[model samples]
Target: MSKSIKLLAMFGFVAAVAACTSGQTEEEYVVVNPEPISVEPTYTGKYK
Candidate 1:
């Protein structure tokens, strides 16, 4: 009877802790906007 009571107490404590805790983690999302790329001007001539 004494061992059974101790085991019951241990199981209750575990159950209480498990009930209070969130098992899964919350995921955070990050959004990134890419910058626009500009094209360089074409070379007209080597020298003026």
Candidate 2:
């Protein structure tokens, strides 16, 4: 019974350490906006 108690304690310690170290990753993000384009008239001469 004593050996089984020691084994359970060791397993619990390992699980706690694994959980603490597995969630430490952080990500960064960036956003960008482009300018709009302008269009001019095609014909400017008078028609008969």
Candidate 3:
């Protein structure tokens, strides 16, 4: 093959690989539970 044709093919292959890898990135989300739990009192206070 000619030098120019070989160079063009190499450039095309590099561009294709770059495009494919560019779409493989992923983003993640982190969740945090911020609500407080409610509970009944263990004992009742007697009136003085």
Reference-based TM-score of each model: 0.46, 0.53, 0.54
Counting clashing residue pairs in each candidate, in order, gives 0, 0, 0
Q: lDDT value for candidate 1?
A: 0.88
Q: Candidate 2, residues 1-48: lDDT per residue as tens digits?
A: 999999999999999999988787657788878666877667867882
When superposed on Cα atoms, how far off is each prediction in RMSD? 5.4, 5.6, 5.8
Q: How many backbone clashes does candidate 1 have?
A: 0
Candidate 3's C-alpha lDDT?
A: 0.89
Q: Model 3 reaches what TM-score against the true structure? A: 0.54
lDDT of 1 by residue, 7-47 (tens): 99999999998877755566889999988798788988998
Which candidate leads in TM-score? 3
lDDT (CA) for every model shown? 0.88, 0.87, 0.89
**Which lDDT value does model 3 have at 46?**
82
lDDT of 2 at 5: 100
- The RMSD (Cα, Å) of candidate 3 is 5.8
Q: Tens digit of lDDT per residue, candidate 3, span 1-48?
A: 699999999999999999999989977889998876887667667863
| CA deviation > 4 Å runs, candidate 3 | 30-48
- Of 1 and 2, which scores higher on TM-score? 2
Model 2's C-alpha root-mean-square deviation from the true structure amounts to: 5.6
